[model samples]
Target: MTTAYWCVLIAIFLPYLATGAAKFFGAGYGPQANSDPRAFLAGLQGWRRRANNAQQNAFEVTPAFAAAVLIAHQVGVAEQLLLDQLAVAFVVSRLLYFVCYLADWGPLRSLVWAFGMAMIVALFVVSA
Candidate 1:
């Protein structure tokens, strides 16, 4: 498996880890809930929604990376160093993107998301 593939896996795993961290820490709580765990549960639930979205995006990239690999092979654009950098950049950008999303940094998160997508696009384009 390529480094990019590993990065993709990490991207998918991060959301779950974040949610788990939220559970371990604490999120939502109210006097009416009659329980402190309720807030934590609510936090987990909210994290689930965000994690699901992240998962969807992560899965979308699998095929995109695979296609890039195939195109690279077919076109003989085997620039291994560039491919490695793109893969690493995609992975790191995705991690940062999710962090920003969870942090609720308006606009900044979207920009990171776009940057990550751009890396994927660059892979396909440069390979061709």
Candidate 2:
């Protein structure tokens, strides 16, 4: 499989990392919390809340990125190296975006989000 394809897998799993953070990284989490993870997650505040939001955002964005990569491969884009690099860059942007969200860096998080979206658009464009 191509590096971009692997990136698609990474993109798929990334949100779980954020959700894990939401469930484990902050106060009040325990084995009992796992019994009602949804409620536990909803009750989170501050950075924990942000982690949940980031997880949601990652889920929202992943499909677009994955579809773009699949479409790129389907159309047989000649610029394989470029596509892989863009995919990697998107993943990096996502990681940074997660951090920015958790740290409450609204401006930088938005910027990184836009960058990842641009990468998705570019993936489609390159495939075309």
Q: Write the per-residue lDDT of candidate 1 for residues 1-35, one digit (tens) a residue.
A: 65655655665565566445454445443454335
Scanning candidate 2 in windows of ten residues, the lowest lDDT window is 22-31
Q: Considering every candidate listed, which one attains the maximal lDDT?
A: 2
Model 2 misplacement above 4 A = none
User: For candidate 2, what is the TM-score?
Assistant: 0.96
Worst 10 residues of 1 by lDDT: 25-34
Error of 1 at 61 (Å): 4.2
Residue pair clashes in candidate 1 = 28-39
In order, what lDDT does every prediction score?
A: 0.64, 0.94
